[model samples]
Target chain A: MDFATLLQILDSALRLATPLLLACLAGLFSERAGIFDIGLEGKMLAAAFFSAAYAYITGSVWLGLAAGCIASMVLAGIHGLASITFRGNQLISGVAINFLAAGLTVLIAQNWFEQGGRTPALEGAARFQNITLPFSETLAPVPVIGPIYSQVISGHSALVYIALLAVPATWYILFRTRFGLRLRAVGENPAAVDTSGVSVTGLRFAAVLICGFLCGLAGAYLATGLSANFVKDMSAGRGFIALAALIFAKWRPWHALGACFLFGLLEAFGNRFQNLSVLGVDVPVQLMQALPYVLTVVILAGFVGKAIPPRAGGAPYVKER
Target chain B: MPKWVDVALIPLINLALALAVSMLVILWIGESPFEALAIMVKGAVGSAYGWGYTLYYTTNFIFTGLAVAVAFHARLFNIGGEGQAALGGLGVALVCLAVPWPHWTLALPAAIVGGALFGAAWAAIPAWLQARRGSHIVITTIMFNFIAQALLVYLLVGPLKASGMSPETAPFPDGAALPTAHDIAPWLGFRPSAPLNISFLLALVACAGVWLLIWRTRLGYEIRAFGHSEPAAVYAGIHPTWIIMATMLISGALAGCMAINSVMGEAERLVINSVQGAGFVGIAVALMGRSHPVGVLLAALLFGMLYQGGAELEFEMPAISREMIIVIQALVILFTGALDNMVRMPIEKFYDARRLARQRNGRGTGVAAE
Candidate 1:
């Protein structure tokens, strides 16, 4: 392929990867603390709806993003209450949260927008503009790698930069900090953390809330940066894909970034190959669309190395006196 | 203080909470909450047509519930029921369309068996993957659901598409179509107008069969014992891995039966998205029923009623979105989970109290006897 075409594909892939990357980081934080956050999809959907609506109304992308994060946090708080306080099954509670968010968002969207199941499209001021790194114009004269560097490496929504930066930030907070030690302790053995004078509940709740914030930002990136409008179920299994990435990466922040990008690349290519049918030689679009999910299953099923989760993951710990 | 009151309290509490939440949503949408609820009640159970629809919906749930419950009994979570059911439908549909069986008697059995085999094969992959690799079934099954959807869409829109039809297969041949209520009414002495079919009977029979399989047989005993404690069961000479795999195969087969009810019984053709949330709904049914055959049957009916009612609310009250059904399902799951948690706590507390009481009483008796 030509350099320009390759650059275009790479840039598009990066934009597409942005949402999954953010969601992977979000899932990383929660799972690291032993909370299985399967409701990431619901949080992302709710955030995307609210952000798209707010952006369309006020024409301020920042306001829209803030609203998205707040809305997602509220849902996350409810999940915390249900699973943590009530000691409900973490998986079931997460599924319920997803169902609730999906239904509620569509219900409100239909009522308010009367657009069936989509928010109003945002204008220029309400959407993020692509960034051009300094001296890219001077470097544009070079052949081949120049376009790849300028277009794919440099130009992207601001959230793309944030998602890339979050890998190290997440790693540091999860491994190097005191909070990280306590979080790990809670996941491994809540009793030990409790005996060590750390409130297991408080730390886990904080982890879930941080998960909510990151998922909200991820949703905002999807609606505002990737697409100007939010459609029903627009997260479109990306959150679940992120969860898979988290597992595939063994719940490590930096590794998850790479996994998310890999999955995202597969998705981007799948979308691109939709209309490339040759005479009497063709691959169905549905099969291509199914690639990421199939890959997830294959990877988890030992096409890759063994994946080990946190010891106490998905268990609700209650101290025995 | 009454025995019946205590026994009935949890379901009642759950129903009340579900109603209240639904009513609040209806009110927020500027609809008459009471009227909407009445419509739901009437639509689900009050009339013959409503009953037929409820029963029809329940048939699918019952099959899928059994699918999930079977795996739960073996302590294996089978979340791939959706994919299994879809594959089952595809199998049945393909058999019905392609098989050249001249007799209805031959075609029907062949199609059903074909569906079961396909579903069993599909589920075996995940079971094998989990058994061999220690991979989590939840993630594998969830991924498989997407793959199944994509495959179904592709087949419907491509190779399997009927001539001159749009992304849908041709209706099954007369010999292949499931005998509906009208078709069988003459022999059974029932009204010809009902929508209910023989699938309900098949579902109930399947439920009974499942109960017998899990309660009476040697295999059932081993499966249940394994569910209670895998290590203990293994020590007792039961192969846990083989049993788990067996449970998944049975579950997937039952899920295949669910797809048959929709494809052969109702639609008379396989359509993309025909499973339509039934697989996920099966999870809630299995959970609410606590994985018992009888309980699953009853819970499936309850969910069927709610689903029918939710649809009725949309037609009678346009102000409320049909999405309320999803919200109600969510509420049911929430309340069911809460009730399960509540029941466990008090039971454990009671056991603790009884143990302590026995210890003190034993000490006093020993002193007196001495």
Candidate 2:
């Protein structure tokens, strides 16, 4: 491929990677805090619908972002209430949340807009616009790095930058703070954390809510940044892919970024090339889309080293008293 | 609490809560909740037509529910029902189209084996991963669901499409079509052409077989023992790998058998999205049914009614919409599966209190008599 084509592909990869990156980081926090969240897909779906609807009504992308986050947070709260306070099975609760979001988003959209469960398209300031980084115009004359810097890196929507920024921020929060220490402690052994006078329930809830916020951002980016309107089941299986990425990353923040980007690059490649030929045999694009999931299965199956989950993940913490 | 209460009352209460929440949602939409409920009930059971659709859906659910329940018996979450059911459809298509059979009687048995085998084969990889490699079945199964969908799309668009505009295989030979409710129930004076077919009977047979396998067989005892306490089962010399593989194989086979209803019975050809979320719905059904064959049947019927009735609501109300039905179903799952203890613990406490009072009364009377 030409250098321009390569740059275009890389550009598309970054855009596609943004939502997955945010979501992978979101899962990192939840899983590290001992909460297994399969409902990431659902939360993102709900946020996408809500953000689009609100942005169309209020004519402000910022308001749309807020609405999306709040909607995601509500679902997250329900997940916490069920799995934590009620001490229900975490996996079952997550599955129910997914069902709830999938249904509720479309139902509410159908009722309010009456356009077959889709929100009105946002325009102008209601949608996220691509940003041109500083010195991009002057740097155009530079040889190898000019197009890479301007075309590939500079012209992404604001959310892409935020998602990229979140990786380092998440790493800092997870590894360099007292709260992070307590959170890791809770995941590995809640009993020890509880004996240390830290509230395991509290730490876990915080982690889950933080996950909700990040998922909200991911969803908002999908609806308002990637596209101008919300489509039914538009998140598709990205949430699940993010989960796969989280597992592939071994629940680390920086590793999550790398995993999500790799998956995103595959998706971009699939989008660019509908079919590819390998050694004179035709390979369909579906196979390309399925590659990440196949790799995740392989990783989990210990073809590589085993990917261990947090010790106390998927179980509610109950005091021995 | 008694076992019966645990089995019956808890699910019933949860179902009531889910319906009540659904009613409130209808009210929020500025519709009469009572009228909506009335419409749903009348639509689902008022006519043979409604019953036909409901039963057709019920048949699909029974297969998938039994698939999940059998796996649950061995403490395995076979979430690959979606993938398995999809592959089952492929199996049915291959068998029905391989040769024009003179009779469905012969085609049916071959289709059953094909569907079961394909479903089991799809699940085998994940089962092996879990049994030997300690990979989580839930993740692998979910990933497989996406892979299965992609596979179906690729085949239908390329190899399976029958010189038509749509991405679906050609209709099977007439003889391969299973007898619908209109055909079989004529002697019983039942009319109204619904998709309901002889597969309903097959579903019931599967249920009975599952009940026998789970309760009457030694394998059932081993599965239950393994589920309840894995360490104890291992100490007792049960092989974990063997149990996991065996349970998942049965689960996948049952899930695959669902294609008999949708592919061979209703559609008479393989079509994309023929499974239509029934695999996921089976999770809720198995949960509400407490993983018992009888319970699965009952739960399947309830969901079948919801689905049929939900379609009716869409036609009548227009405001309630189809997605609302999904919300209602989600509420049911949330209450019955996740928040089950919200109702169970209170009832348990009530029963404990009653037992204590009865014991005190008996002891006091004995002292007085002495």
Candidate 3:
């Protein structure tokens, strides 16, 4: 492939990676707090629909983002009420929430728009436009660094930059803050945290709510930023892919960005070359699409490196006293 | 306080709550919920035609629900039912297409064996991973689901595709066709086109078999023992790996058997997306049924009605789409499975107070409540 083609692929990869990166960070927080949320996909889907719908109605992207975030947070709150307060099985609650979001989005969309569960395409102010950074015109003359900086890095929606920025912010919050220490302690040993007079429930809820907010940003990016409107099931298993990326990252903030970008690059290539072959043998498009899942399974099976989860992950806490 | 309350009354109340939510949703969409209900009941069970479709759908749910319940008994969440069912469908297609037998009686047995084996094999890797490698079965099984989807697509459009451009195989051999409800009992005056088949009977037999295995056998005891407490079970000389592997195999086999209803009985061919979302619906059924075979049967029937009725509901009222069924199913799962204690707590408090009052009045403990 030519350098231009490679740069173009990287640009799309950056765009695609934005949503996955945000969603991965979302899972990182929730899972780090011992709240294993399989509802990430559902929240993203619901948020995508609401964001697009509100953006179309008000012709304001900011309002759409707000609506999307609220929708996701509401789902997360329901999850907390079930898994945290009621002490129900976390997996079952996650499954229920996913179905709720999946069904509600399509049902409401069909009822409101009659457009087969899709919002009308956003125009002008309802959509996020790509921003080209300064000195791109002058930077074009420079060799390798110019195109990589200007073309590949500069031209993306604001959400892309935000997602990239969130990685470092996530690192700082999780590893360098007192709240982060308490959050990790809760996930690892809630009974210990409880004995210390820290509210385990409170910390977990904070983590889950933050998860919702990040997922909301991911969904909003999917609908208005990456594309102009919401399509039914447009998240398209990205939430699960993000979850897989979380596992691949060993639940670390910085590692999550690398994992998501790798998956995104694979996706970009799969999109670009359906029939391209390096060897004499034919490669099917489906195999390319299935690679991430297969790779994750291998990783999970411990053939590569160990990817252990939090000590108390997927368990509902009960007071020892 | 009573076993009967847990088995019957609690689920019934939860179901009521779910239906109530559905009603509100219908109202929100500017449709009359009562009229919609009437239409759904009529469309799902008022006629033999509707019953046929409902029972047909019920058969599939029974297999999938039992599949989930079996794994759940061993404390394993087999969320990969959708993928397992697809692979089972692949097995059915292979067996049915392999030979031109003169009778379905012969074909059915071969298909069952093939389907079960394929389903079990598909689950084996994930189970082994959880058993020996300490990998999370939940994540691996889910990944296997995506892989299964891709594999099915690859097989269909490549080696398995028929003469047409469509990504499905040609019909199974004529002899492999199972008898429909109308064929079995023409005196009932059912339409020949009704999809209900002998697979419904097979589903009941499987349910009975599962009930026997779970409650009447030693392996069942071990599974229950492991689920209740792994450390205790391990101390009792039961191997955790053995229980996990055996339970998952049975679960996958049952899930795979669902293809017999949709593929061999009705479609008579291997098709893309044939399982649709029936596999996921099994989770709701298993949860609502409390993972008991009898409960699974009842829950599967209710869902079947929802499936058939929701189709009719959409036909009668465009305002309420078919996706409305999923919403109702979700509510049912949420109330019955996740927020079960929400209702359980208040009921427990009320029952406890009444019991204490009765005891204080010198009524014996075993007396039935008036």
TM-score of each: 0.92, 0.98, 0.98
List DockQ, one per candidate, in order.
0.62, 0.83, 0.83
Model 1 segments beyond 4 Å from truth? A275-282, B1-8, B186-195, B342-370
Ranking by DockQ: 3, 2, 1
User: Model 3, A81: alpha-carbon shift in Å?
Assistant: 0.8
Q: Give lDDT tens digits, candidate 1, residues B68-93.
A: 99988887878788899999998888
Give me the TM-scores of chain B across the candidates.
0.88, 0.96, 0.96
Mark the 10 consecutive residues where model 1 chain B has the least summed lDDT.
B1-10
Task: Pull out the clashing pairs in model 2.
Answer: none
lDDT of candidate 2 over A1-321, digit per residue (tens): 799989999999999999999989988988898888999999999999999999999999999999999999999888888887788887888888898999988888988999898998889999999999999989987997998999999988989999999999998898899999998888899999999898888998899899999999999999999999998999999999999999899888888889999999999999998878889999999899898899899999988877999999888888998
Candidate 3 chain A, poorest ten consecutive residues by summed lDDT: A274-283
Model 2: per-residue Cα lDDT over B1-370, one tens digit each: 6777888878899999999998999999989999988899899998888888989999999999999999889988888899999999999899999999899999999999999999998889999999999999999999999999999999999988999899999999998989889888776545645899999999999999999998999888889999999999999999999999989998999999999999999988898988999999999999998999999999999999999999999999998889887898889889998898889889988887777776688854433332
Q: What is the Å distance of residue B274 in model 3 from its true position?
A: 0.9
Q: Show the lowest summed lDDT stretch of 10 residues, model 1 chain A.
A: A1-10
Q: What digit string (tens of lDDT, one per residue) describes model 3 on residues B206-265?
A: 999999988899999999999999999999999999999999999999989999999999
- Give the DockQ-based CAPRI class for model 2: high
Worst 10 residues of 2 chain A by lDDT: A81-90
